[model samples]
Target: TPVNHTFGISGGKQFKVGADNNPLSFFIVGSHGTNYSYTGELIRNTTSDGTIYQDQQGDKYSQNINQLVLGNINFGINKAHNLAYNFMMVHANNQYVGQYSGKHTESHQDSNDYTGRAIRQQTNDNLLFTHQLISSWKLSNKMKLNAGASYNRIKGLEPDRRENYLSKQDDGTYILTGSNRQKRFFSELKENDINTKVNLQYKLNDEFDNTNSALEIGYNGRFVDDKFEAVEYNFDALSGTFPIDNLQLDDLYNQANYESGKYTMSVGELNTYNVKKNVHSAYAEATYQLTSPLTANVGLRVDNVDMTVNHRVQHVEPGRESIKKTYFLPSLNLKYDLNDKNAIRMGLSKTYTLPQSKEISPYQYVNIGFASQGNPNLKPSDNYNADLKWDYYLSPSELFTVTGFFKHIVNPIGRVDQGNSAGLLSYSNISAFATVAGIEVELRKNLINRVNTATSKVNRVSLGLNASYIYTDLEVDIVNTPRR
Candidate 1:
């Protein structure tokens, strides 16, 4: 069993008014303080020695504090138009400490028996501001248009601090040196993201006197700019006895020796990079009612993406890379009514997946006895999917559903462990293509409707159950075998 310890407070308010029959609302919400002090036990039954040695048993506790503030304003400009604005900010600080016991003489250079201490602290601050404008117009008795535009700005920063105690001996055997000897690492990152998008949709209905038949055409344009900067520092190993509870980090940095001169600089493992991505897409679909009990929908979409990265390579040379790709996706969906209480649905589609900024960056994360790194040469993945579903309406408040899904994906990404610097984990594209299939069954019921005679429209009790089974086959292309 595990224990949870947390406490927090939150408050919010909303203001609303009606001006000339149009409603306007403004709201603000704020939450501050902490939900922290979580302690846990880790069981490690094995023991190892040497440079790659680590303790298996330990007591770990973590503390987290955060604050959130959000504000929104929305109003109807007219019956067919609306405008809204939202702003949110969050700040968090997290700290963790762990204690482990082991044979000190076998690992540390010193002869004294000591318990290992590991401390980690990090802080993150984020801000997001967005504005959206939407409009709806009835062009004709059977036609409608919906359009919207949004602009967003995001900014964030992360500062991480890690420290450990270890000893180095002239004979090349290192051991747990306790708190008297310390090794510290610090990393700071800043990021800014700006995005703008515009979307327009038009619908036409009642074609050929069939009220259920419709056609829809949509176009979307987006522009994105993201910038990142990171700096890392390593403090020279210090020898002394001091209380860690009241240790001032700023004073320590100023008094302690630095491995890279007096000031921290970006070099080698601390290299920095920047990446930018832009996408434009458009789609069109048509829905036709072939019969009173059946309907069909077909659609096509096109997407164009451009990605650029700028960074320094291993030889300290400026390097630039760019990728431009386009995709044409098509989809079809069909629905048929077997009876008043039963229906079946089938769908087929093509999809694309892109990598995130962190996944494509060449940054590295370091920890005791382990480290994880990123890959910059990752490519996008494409997937083809098909799904069939059947739904049965047992009653007004109850239903049963069964679904089967299949997918064929190309270029799946996975992690690999590298025995460098003792051990390191990295991400890469592992398979050329993969196939996946799954089946799911779901049932939902309103207990109030089946157990008690109630006149109220709302159901006081409800139950839902679902289960699924999946199968996958992947073709290995990069490594010898999959890690997991």
Candidate 2:
């Protein structure tokens, strides 16, 4: 059935290399795919008093993708250490083709009604790559160590995006005689991320299960760099011969038109932005069992973040931003076994949410019906969480669970409509605090009866489902500004 919408081919290989004494195992996989998709959309804008109205919409998309993965694992001759390396790359060609037509009828005196059409074509190239290296070693009989590092990068480019509009006249003919009638948009974005971690675990006693006690310590580092730039061009048509019925865009936009004084172009907006983020963290955790039916795990972590942002527009104020934050996060988890088939769990933690690079940049982009801008002064939100859960084991292949949770957040970030304009949107802090509460239920069942041993076995027929109900509360002050 999938063949009707998508066509793809894939293959992989597994091989060994190096000396037989140490022997490295390698794996390689690759795939290619092409897909076509279309979505139906209807956009309507109307006044609250059943008065003015406008409608516009379009949706069409297609893509071609290719991916490759390569990895290798090796064990030392003496089995002292194990190591692995992995790399992956994916590339895609994407395009969106849409013809938008709209009608505006405002219900008011001294107002005029109009209809127009727009031609839209957007094409982009996207690429992603990831690389990782990992190693494990047994320091002693009760201690083990793990270290790993990873790097990833992504790039997106739009060389040319065309959006041309034409308006209808009293004679029932279309002409390009309005602002922003012919436009071209171009943008490029690239992001690089690097992360590294080192962890060590030590056993307190000889036991390895049930009454086992252990301690873990780890160090983590993360670094990110992102850069983005975009430029828009507005074109003006000259006096020349043109086609109206069944118009062809490619032919009409020929370079000869510019040389023949039939088309002129000017820059509209130029936006550029860059971001750098660095985070370092250290953590320690301990797990111990105090009783036969009860176990506890506690952890403490400290994280420090440094971020910088720079954004500039052609004719607007240049933007510069910097932020530094430190967090002391603590977590606790407790589990109690009420019986052989039932258990209870409780968890408490303190966490925070970091702002994405795009969300922290002061950049604005406008489309047909809407315009959006980011906030450079946004702050991260701090969260306090608590949860209680009960789990039931109906059988070796079945499970049921119910959970209740609550969270409180400070300095929550949200999108707000300026109210002055129906299409203007911006991001800011919503309020002082917000509360979220939820309840969840989950179930897992086996459709076929198979092995019922204590060890986990592969199940061919299994089904799982979960559902949740949540309530959220927040408050904000509204601002009124007259639109021009």
On TM-score, the leading prediction is: 2
Global Cα RMSD, each model: 6.2, 4.2
Clash total of candidate 2: 0
Best by lDDT: 2
Per-residue lDDT of candidate 2, residues 212-297 (tens digit)? 58899999999999999999988885443344468786676679977887778889667999999999999999988867788889
The residue-by-residue lDDT of candidate 1 on 348-422, one tens digit each, is: 999988777666766666554445676778888899999999999998778999999999988877666543432
The window of 10 residues in a row where model 2 has the poorest summed lDDT is 1-10
Query: Model 1 compared with the native: what TM-score?
Result: 0.76
TM-score of 2: 0.87
CA error at residue 39 for candidate 1, angstroms: 4.4
Candidate 1, residue 134: Cα displacement in angstroms equals 2.6
Q: After superposition, how far is residue 195 of candidate 2 from its true place, in Å?
A: 0.7
